[model samples]
Target: MKPSGTASAHSDTFARDHLPPAGQWPELVFDLPELLYPDRLNCGYELLDRTAERFGDDRPAFRSPDGGVWSYGELRDRVDRIAHVLTDDLGVVPGNRVLLRGPTTPWLAACWLAVMKAGAVAVTVLAQQRPTELATICLLARVGHALCDIRSVEDLLKAQVPGLRVTAFGGGAPDDLTQLAAARPGPYRAVDTAADDVALIAFTSGTTGRPKGCMHVHRDVLAIADTFAHHVLRPGPDDVFTGSPPLGFTFGLGGLVIFPLRAGASSLLLEQAGPKQLLPALAAHRVSVLFTAPTAYRLMLDELDGHDLSALRRCVSAGENLPAATWQSWHERTGLRIINGIGATELLHIFISAADEAIRPGTTGTPVPGWQARVVDSDGEELPDGEPGLLAVRGPVGCRYLADERQSQYVRHGWNITGDTYVREPDGYFRYVARADDMIISSGYNIAGPEVEEALLRHPDVVEAAVVGRADELRGQIVAAYVVLREGAEQSADSLCAHVKSELAPHKCPRAIEFLPSLPRTATGKLQRFLLRTSPDPHGRVALE
Candidate 1:
C-alpha cells in the first residue's frame, strides 16, 4: 500500500523506501550499449523464457549430479508454475520480498526465477548460516515470504518473522513446492516489472565482522553476465558449467547459474560439491567450464592422481587471490591456465578478470571489459603503475547498499573504492597486494602481507598461508603468519621464516609464524584475517626457534 512512484510497488515498500539516499549512490556508468536495459523487464523472462525461444525449447539448461538435465523449456515451465503458486496461492504481490534458503538444488534455482517472475524480490541466503545470522538478514530485508528445503530450513524457520508465508520444497512435506507443482504446473505470465525494481539483496560475508545488504536490480543481474561471463568466459550452448560456490554467494550465483543460462549453456548443480566430489562429477558430466575458489583448486590438485580433467576448457578462480604457485601448479597438472580475478559483493560480481590467453600468471589481469578500474591513493587520486594503492572501480553494476552509513565510505565521490590494495603493471595487468586494512606498517615501513604469503606458498612444504599484522609495542605492528604446512613436512617455524627471508625483503618476512592444521576461511574460500587478529593464543606463536 505504498504510494506509487516511478515503478510499481505492490508491497516491497520496506526495501525501496529504506534504500540509501540518491546522492549517496555511486555514479553508475553504463558505457556499453548492452548495459542499457528496457524500462519494463523481468530477468526471469530474459534468463529463462526468451532464452528457451532462441535456443530450441528443448535445449538443455541445468544438469545435476544425479537428477537428469533440465531443458530450457522445462526450466521456464517450472518457473512459471512456481510463480503462479506465489501470486495466486500464497498472496505474493509484485515488489514483495521472498526469502529462499536451500541446498544447491535445481528446485532452489526454480524458486529464484519464480520469485522474480512474480515481480517479487529474492533474498537468497546461505543454507548453512547460523540462526542468528539468518534472523538478522530476515529483519534487514523485511522478508515476508520464504521458500526453503526442509532438510536445511531449521534456521530459516526460526529466523522468519511472523506473518511469513513459508513453503517447504523438499523432504516430502504435505505442502512442499514439489507437491504443489505436481498438482498444477503450467504457463504463468511473468510480471512486466520496471528494470529499476530491486530484484535481489545479496549479503556480504561480514569479513569486517558486520554484514551489509547489497541491493541489485533486474538489469544489474544481466549486466554482470553480459560483462564478465559473456566477454571473459565465452561460454556457448555446448559448454557444461559446474562449480563449488553456494547460490547465496554472488560468485556462485553469477558463475554457476547466470553465466551458463545467459550463453544458452547448462550447468551441473552438485549438492555436496567438495573437491573430492567435484572431480568425479566433472568427468562423469563432462563439465567443460569449472568455477571454484583457489583453495578448492589447490585441494583438487592434491587428489588429481591424473584425474581426467581434459573436459575442462575454462577454469575460473575467484573469491580470493590465486597464488602464483597454485595457478602454476594447476596448469602444470591439468594443462589449463586458471583464470584469476578480483570481485566484490558491492560490485555484484567480477569487474576485473581475464580468461584463456589474456591471463597473466600471478596477476588478476586487467579490468573487465565494460568496466574501468585503477589504483588510487588515499585522496582518491589515481596512482601510477607499480605503486600499490586502493583499487577503485566504476561500472554499470556498482555499490548500492541498503540504508547503511557505510555507503558513503564504500562509495566515495562516485567511485566504489574496493578495500583491496592492488598494484597496476604498465601492461595493464593488476596484481593484488593486500587489503588496505591488511597492510602492515612497522618502523616507518609499509608491507603487504599477501606479498610475503605468496613467497611462503612457493615452498614445497607449504600448503596454505595467511599473513596479518600483529601488534608490537616497539614497531607498532609486525608481519605475522598463520600457515598450514603439508603433513610430515618441515614443521619448524624458523625453517619457514628463513625460507621467506630468502624470497622477500628482510622486513616482509613473518616476524612470528604459527603452523596451523588449517587456515580460517569463509564458506566461499576467502581468508578471514580478522579472526587471526583476535586469536586467543597469540603468545603460542613460535619465537624464532
Candidate 2:
C-alpha cells in the first residue's frame, strides 16, 4: 500500500497504530471518476451538513416512531451539537476509538455522525451483545469513550471495561447525551480529516467465531454510496427508506443511513422491526425502498394480503444469500423485483448487486460500476466461466482488518478473496454456490448446501431449512437437514426425503432429518450455520438409509 498522500488530522493515533502492516493491505482500485476523493474529507459533514446545503435544509432526513421528523437542517444541527459534546466535553480527540451502543434510533444515528465529525474512530456494537462480547470488542479496539442508549447501558456497565468512559443518550437525565447536546446548540466545525484516516471499525457478526474488526476510512464510506447506491440502486431524494438491520451491521448502516442520506432521501428509524412490525410500518410510513434479508421476505409473504404495498418500488436483500425461490415468490406477489446483492463487513457495503431490468433471477448481477470480480480456484488461478470457485473482488474500497492475523487469508495477490464459492457465467453474472466451508462432500459427490436448502424450501410444508455435513464413518460425510415446517404442518422425514430426491439428485438428499421450531440466526438476521452445526442432536448417529 502506498503511503497516504495527506497528513492525518488525528491527535490520538491508536486507530492508525493498530492497523495491519502495509504488506497485509488489499489492493484498492479506483477505476471510476467519482471515486477520486479529495485529501481532506469528512463523511459526516458530506452526508449531513453538505447535503443540507446542496439539497434543501427543510427536507426530511430521519423519522422517529413517535411521529417526530428531523429535517436535514435539524439533523445537521443535532450532529454539530453532539460533536461539541464529544470534543469539548468528553475530551475525545481524533483517532480515539469511541464505542457506540444503542438500538436503531435518531439519537444513535446522531451519535455516529458526531464521532465521525469529530474525527474519532467509531466502534459500533449491537445492543443485544452480552458483557463478554462487549468486553472482547472493547479490548480489541482499545476503546476509551462510549456513547450508549440510556436503556441499554446496563450490559456495557456490566462489561466493566477498564478506563472506559460511558455517556448515555435518549433520556432526560443531566448526564444524558440528549440533555448535553441540547445544552450546547451552537454549530461545531467538522475536523479536516485525511480521507484515508480510519473512520470506523465494524466487527464481523457472531455467525463467525471471534469477530474480526474491519477497518474502513472516510473515503471508503462514501465510495459505497458512489459505487453501489449511485450506479445500481439509483435511489432518489423522494424515496422513504426502512429496513430491519441495526446500525451496527454495515448492511444496515449503508442501506438505512448512508445510502438514503447520500441520495438526499429520508429513512424511518425502527427499534423493533420484525416481519410483523415491518409490514405495518412499510404501509403506514409509505416506505418506497426496503432493505432486509430473504428470511424476512419469506415470512412477510404470508401476511402480504393484509398490508398495502403500493408505495414500495424497490427492495434490497442482503445479510445472507437470497434464494431464487424467495425472489420469484416476492416478484409474483408484489410485482417488484428484489435486488439481490452480496456484501461483507470488511468491504463496508454491497459491492455486487442488480436492480430492476438488469436483474437476472437466481444470479447476483454483475459487479457494480466501480468494482471488478472473478472466480478463482484454491491456488488463486482464474477459473473458467462455468466453473465454481472462490470469489475474488477488487474495488475502490477493500478489506482492512485491524491487528488481525486473518488479514493475509482475506486479501491475496491484491484481491479480496471472499470465502464464498461462486460461478461466473458466460454472461458475466455471478451465481453463488455456497460458502467454501459449506460444501458437503459425501463419498466423491460434491453438493452445495444452499442448493439443497433451496430444494427443501420448494417443499410446501417446509418454512425454512438448513443443511450441514455431519461426520460419517462410511460415506466420509452425510448431508443433515434441520427444518422448520409450516405452522400446524406435519410431514414425516421419509416424505421430506422423497421430496428432495424428486427435486435434486438422490445423493443430495439428507440422510438425517431433524425438525426444529426455528433455525438459529444472529441479531442481524444472518443464519448462524456454526450454531446449527454445533447444536446437539437428540438422536445418535444414523446408519445410511
Q: What's every prediction's RMSD, in angstroms? A: 2.3, 1.2
Question: Across residues 1-545, which tens digit of lDDT does each residue of candidate 1 receive?
Answer: 11124565446566677777888787787788898777777898899888888888888888888769899988888888889889878889987889898889889999998988898989998888888888888888878899998887777777657677788988676688877876665998888887778889999976777799998888889999989888888889999999999899999999888888888999898888899999988889999999899889888888988567778899999898888889999899889988898889888899898888888898999988889999999899999999988999988887778788999999877789999999999999999988888999977799988888888888888888888988889899888888888889867777887888898888787777788899887766678999998885444365532
Q: For candidate 2, give the lDDT of residue 77.
A: 89
Please give, for residues 416-464, the per-residue lDDT of candidate 2 as tens digits: 9999999999999999999988999998999999999999998988889
Off by over 4 Å in 1: 1-6, 537-540, 543-545
Best by TM-score: 2
Indicate the worst ten consecutive residues by lDDT in candidate 2.
536-545
Model 2 stretches astray by more than 4 angstroms: 1-3, 538-544
TM-score of 1: 0.97
